[model samples]
Target: MRDGIPRFVPEDNYGKSFGYQWNLHRLTQLDSYVGLPVSRDRLLRESGWTTDELEGREVLECGSGAGRFTEVLCQTGAAVTSFDISNAVEANATSNGRFAGLRLLQASIYDLPLMDESFDYLVCLGVIQHTPDVERAFKTIFRYLRPGGKFCIDVYAAIVAYPHLRQLLRPVTKRIPPGKLYGVVQSITPRLLPVSTRLSAVPWVGDYLTRLVPVANHRHLGLSDTETVRTWSVLDTFDWLSPQFERPQPRRRLERWCRDLRLSEFEIERIRGLYVVRGTK
Candidate 1:
């Protein structure tokens, strides 16, 4: 393997923005780095899989950006095969390479180098919406799951008739090179965050007004430290704007997809503005 990590896709592709951002903010979202269980909590809640259940099982993690969840998965004593469509695999390896039972690869979700019905569990979080064809990507990954294997995924939720400020700016922001776009986000976040924070406190208008500001302010997340809040704001704001594809799907549509796949015991529910789907094949 090149550089001690398996490479499937070319070093540059549509996920370049993700690769750049994750490498730059390598440790930003990791629970180990943040001294919080944010990543672990989300993984557990969304997957409904306890660490005890995962121990000694096999888990295939797609779109493992910077290994935020990879770190938690590796700690579970599971054999974790984590891959990304971007060079974020490098960042993931840097963060979690030392963990036993962890394998890092740079690969596309559409064309994975794995056997069908091979994995016991598959998880794709905050990823499918970024792919060119969400359904195809889902089916491709699902093919890798063994019979009775469990899966968990989350996608951005569609809001009917709502004018999302991020979507309005993405056309321009996504076209800009990720390195330059990151700088733009950094410069604007400090200025707009204060205003957004103030507006977010207002009753009804606050949510609307806060949307007008492009920066992602995480004041409500209980990050007590001001510097940490600022760092998260800048990182998340860049993440929000720099993606090449950011498709949000309706909850019903996601449920329909699960039905089409004939995934048993499947449920699609909203969690923190994302539609999280969990089921077994």
Candidate 2:
């Protein structure tokens, strides 16, 4: 298999950009402030993912972005194999150096190189939607999990009432990739709040204007790598500008596909803008 995406050492790139770190730092700050909307820590707490739940189990974390979930899974005592398609792996490797039992690898979701049925628990979060083929990716994940083992994941939701509203913003952000614009907006939008309080009073036009202008200072989680955050954002914007397609399949449609794979669908939840479902494979 190919080596994972090389670590994005922005020291090699950031010198030329303006206000880059501001945008990046602010996004990292946002991460610490809120729980990952994919059921949040509440789901992790309920799933018994605390220390004893993953004890001695073989866990595979697909799309272990920046190692946030990896750190959580690590607390559970499971041996985790962290994987992703981008430089996040290298960032994870660098960020996760102090931790052991972590095997970081980078590769495509549809074509994972590991052997079949290799893990007792497969934790693939925030990844299925970004894949070119969500069905095949699900099938690939199913292959990695042991029989009766669980695979938990959160997918982008199309069924939510505001997607059309969000989708309509595409024209304004048409320069942004439909896939990644949300990531950009989540980070950049919050910083615009000073004027946002004033601007929000306007109609739909207000939000658009707020989004177009870059804020002077952003926030950070302090635990995060400031450089990686900037790189992730710019790349996310680039990714949205050029993507696999416009949007991904809805949650129910993905659920049906999971059914087709003979995977048992056990939990499904509709959060603010995402539909999260986890199952046993």
Candidate 3:
């Protein structure tokens, strides 16, 4: 075990694209750069959690890529056990490792080497849809929650209109090596993002028009500045294209998964096209 966290090595990185991408923009989603703590607010708002509740609590953060959310969790005074399936854990550790109540682990969600019922709360965001099996990933983390403890998660929603272009293009893009694909996106994103920004401004059909293109649309998320939107655009576009598995879950399917896990107090919020679900064990 390293740093008091068990180790489970993966046969190969199923999410190596994420590993490379997060390390590239490790601090983009972080609040420090924007002075807003957007990730923190999203977590608390979606989870219905308060600083008072997080303080002194034991929290497990799954798929904590590059520690963007881990920084927020640390600020809550919660004892955070953060893990990722990539060397992005190195980036997270470099930035937040010195915090008093944080533990780091590098393991896969399919088989985590942690004790059951070991945490007071669990927070997983922006990760489930990327996993090979969303249900199995959900259950694996749910088993780590203490009875009556809350779990917060978010996944890509199955928007029939959204991702239409991504789906069509992924068959070709997924096969390209991660680095080569990133170079391709880097060349195209600058030109396409501005167009998406303007197209998204149109009324009625603007949303659909923007969705027709694969460039990441942070416009709907209220990010307007040229540089900020561009950064998010590059990061998100790479994120959408590079993953080995991409599954957008339907609302009913998510609810059924919660029921299958015997979780209670289940609440779901549709925030900016992402399905955020919170429930209790």
Highest lDDT against the true fold, candidate: 1
lDDT (Cα, tens digit) per residue for candidate 2, span 1-281: 32433332233221111113222333332233333322236347334355576788899988765666776676567798877765455445555645677777766666677889989888776567666667777677778888888767766677542333334554456454333554665566445434544554568776445344443212222224445444444444433333333445576787687777777556667764466667677
C-alpha local distance difference test of each model: 0.88, 0.56, 0.84
Write candidate 3's Cα lDDT for 1-281 as tens digits. 65444457662588778878888887788787666667777888888889888999999999989888899899889999988887678678777877999988889887777899999999999888888888899888888899999889998888752456888888788788988999999889999987887888899989878877789877655665678888889988988888888888889998888888877689887876789999788
- Cα deviation at 150, candidate 2, in Å, is 1.2
lDDT of 1 by residue, 91-155 (tens): 99888989979988899998888888989999999899889998888778999999899999998
TM-score of 1: 0.97
Please, what is the TM-score per model? 0.97, 0.65, 0.94
TM-score winner: 1
Off by over 4 Å in 1: 160-162
| Model 2 bad stretches (over 4 Å) | 1-48, 161-191, 194-248
Off by over 4 Å in 3: 1-7, 160-163, 221-224
